[model samples]
Target: MIGVSGTLVRGGTSKCWLFDITDVHGRGASLEDVLLAAFGSQDHSQIDGVGGATSTTSKAAIISHSYESGVDIDYTFAQVGVGVNEVEWGSNCGNCGTAVGLYAVQSGLVRPRGEQTTVRMRNTNTGSRIDAVVDTPGGRFTPSGNATIPGVASPGVAVGLEFLDPVGSTTDALLPSGAAVDDFTLSEGAAHATLVDAGAPAALFDAEALGLTGAETVAEFGAALPSLLGLRHRAGVHMGLAAPGGPVSHAVPKFGVVGAPRDYTATDGTRIAAADYDISVRMASMHAPHPAIGLTSTVAVAAAATVQGSTVHAHAKARDGEIRLGTPAGVVSARLVLDGERLTGVRLNRSARVIARADIFVPRAERVPVALP
Candidate 1:
């Protein structure tokens, strides 16, 4: 058996298995095999591994102390397929981004400079930089605080993150099609969608256009997965996210719908007032409605809201300052700094906690090699 030591951290609404880069062996096909074994990717339930059998829980973060001047750490986010036997490294995870600083400080990868330490992180996946600030009283990372985000049960240390130059993280353009709103015809019907690449590539549509009220429960949305995915696959081709006439199963560019804010019940059965938010958004990860808001999607939503003719912009009110977006879990806000026609940066705060630390043992049989091009 091969043992890999790592920590499991709950960052924002997702959990990730964090590993130091130097400790992980192999590359390319070999690395993929190792990860599949570590997470038990061939099984739907992931019962043989640490994965929680869901997209949110089947994530990994590979971190290394940065040698680049001005950057403190380099992070590469990986989306490990549950039963598909694939590992996609195309985009970064904003939820896991919040935990990078905590792991760095606690693991001595970075030393706190003052009461609060700001770690400049370089996302190797997208070549984007994010400034993550964590509260470090007396030069130590603190995980206890009053910071609370939707989906998370309790308060934890506040991690302020600013995604700098968030545009075009995955694709070559912010508006991949050179238009804010594009029309696509699917088997269901015609739909208007916005393809934005802020922090991550995402396709956004008006819920009404998709025959959704934007307040559907998780189960209701799951029942509509076929239609939703059909729209997503077409949008993916339109935005060059996927090859034309090819099968689409990759996690991104993400798919979501936006609507005018309305009163709705959260996943935890708590009522959310529409008056508190500017718009409502429901996003899908791996073809299912996300239990909570995704950090990268929040950035894309903020960017879409600022652009004219987009669905989010049409329903958005009180444009300046923070934009509160109501999701199935609750509301998550993003503050956008606009410079005329360009978006300068996006800022938001999330909480994270170290859940467990242990050695993941991979059997020799699971590490068998596969042919690669």
Candidate 2:
């Protein structure tokens, strides 16, 4: 039996399984099926896999040594849906960036240093350079921390990942289609819509168009699937995404609502004062509410919030550059580059860690088919 190992670690608000692809001989389609059978499904129980039910947990990482300059590791991200057999290799998830550095240090891929170790990562999926810094004390990899993040249960070590040239990681162009924004008139009698693809392609619509407060809670929006689906369909067309023949299936260009920052209770029951945030935004993954926030979408939202002609909040004396956000969990900052009327880039900060390191048992089916010698 071929042995393949994986490590389960928390990066920002999301978790994933990190693997060493170079060590594994057969990690292509056969191995992908094995991973699905092991962790892809939506029963909430996940039964016999490692998935944690939420989109944040249905992820995997394949790490390898890179030949690129200023980069030591190449990280490829995969998003596996629960109860589904397909694995999406679309874009990069910023939450998993922290794990890259920690994993590199633990595996002796990078020399461990005191206090902090900086590792350069080349995101294979997005072709971006992520500068990851991990906490290493006494020349040992130590990740224990007391710093609290909003969505996580307890405090853990902090690893910061900064993505350089974060725009157009997926589609090659910052706007993907060379358009600052695309407007699709809804097929159903809704209203005009604008789709933006700065960080992640997303569709923007007025909260009033859907009888939303623009200040509604996460649960409130999640419960309105039919309406959300309708919007998602319209957004898919505008963003030039493959229509799943229905609504959006792969959670691209996240759907968000922007409003003037006002005093309101968050999902955690914390009172969010208007002065705390420049603008308030909420996004979705498929039809479910994100537990706390998503790093990629956060970048997109912050970028859109600063734009002058989007459905985002219009009265905050919009900033001329990058914007900082206060979410239910804590503060998340992203950089927004505006060239003329086009959004150039939306860079985000994230962290990753290495929880476990060892070899895993690979099933026969997961191994390459053998031709008898």
Candidate 3:
């Protein structure tokens, strides 16, 4: 057995376990083998390990100090599949980046610079740069704080992330298809999709085109999971996320539906009015609906809104780089800094807390497959 210690941190709306690079790979084991075993990917319920089983919870990242100029930390995000026994390393997680920022300074990877310490992170998975401004009072780290996010009830330390140069995070262009609006031929029929590569590659279709309001609850999104995955596959191919007639990723080219803002009941039973938010979105995180909007997807939504004919742009109400997205949990706000046609950065307020520190044990290196490419 291989025993490795990891930190469990709740960043933004999701939870991810952070591990030091050396601890997981000093034995020369494959990243997927270690992470899959650590998260108990073989079991759907993850009863044998620390994985929370849900898409948002079953996540892990390897952290290390970066020697790269202008970057303080580098991390590789792994979306460890539940029951599926797969680990997807093709995308970046904004929520995970939030956790890594706090983890970096808290663990002394980066020296805290009083008041607001900036931890510049590069997600090696997608090559996206995120400036995580952590709240370090008097140059000291605090484990918890009064800052709260939309989905989580508990408050934590505030970390504002500025996604620097987020355009074409995975692909090479903001509009990967070279157009703001691209028509994707779905199995049922043709659907017009706005495929934006900012933050992460995301393909958004008008919710009405899919026979539902974008403000639908998580369960509603789950009910249409099959159709959503199908759309994601096609979008991935269109965005060059995958080769045509090739194995498409179920993760990237984030699939979702967008709609005009309207009245809806939140998961917490709160009433949200049309005027309260700019647009509505129901995004699928892997196999199910993301209970709360992923910040990276929020970045994509904000980027798409800037386009003239994008689906998100067509439904959004807010202007001047302020985007308020209505999710299942509540509304998430993203601020875009623009210089003429150039998008300087995207800033978002998030809360993160160190949930637990644990020693995880997994099967020996030779016992797990190292065949994943």
Per-residue lDDT of candidate 1, residues 1-373 (tens digit)? 7888889988888889999986676633366677888898889999888888999999999999889999999999999989868898877898889888778877888888888888899999889899888878887877577788889888877888899999987776889999989998766678898899898889998889888877778877778767678778888888887799987656678888889989999999999998989988888888778887788889999988878889889887866767999988888889987787789899998888888888988755535667998
List residue ranges in candidate 1 displaced over 4 A.
26-29, 187-189, 366-373
lDDT of 3 by residue, 269-365 (tens): 9999999999999998876788988888999999999999899988898577799999999999999999898777999999899999998888764
Query: How does each model score on TM-score?
Result: 0.94, 0.83, 0.95
Better of 1 and 2 by TM-score: 1
- CA RMSD of all predictions: 3.6, 4.9, 3.4
Query: Candidates ranked by lDDT, best first?
Result: 3, 1, 2
Candidate 3: misplaced stretches above 4 Å? Answer: 185-189, 365-373
lDDT of 1 at 36: 80
123: Cα error in model 2, Å: 1.8
Error of 3 at 188 (Å): 7.0
lDDT of 2 by residue, 1-373 (tens): 4456788887888888887786544654465665665573534566656777668888888898988877889988888778666777777777776766677787788887788888888888667777777767777776566555666666666676665655556555544444444444555455533455545666656555666655567677677645666667766765667645654547576676655667777767777777766665666775676655677777666655655566664534366565656554544566665667655555555555456655655444444556999
Collision pairs in model 1: none
Clashing pairs in 3: none
Top candidate on lDDT is 3
Tell me the lDDT of candidate 1.
0.85
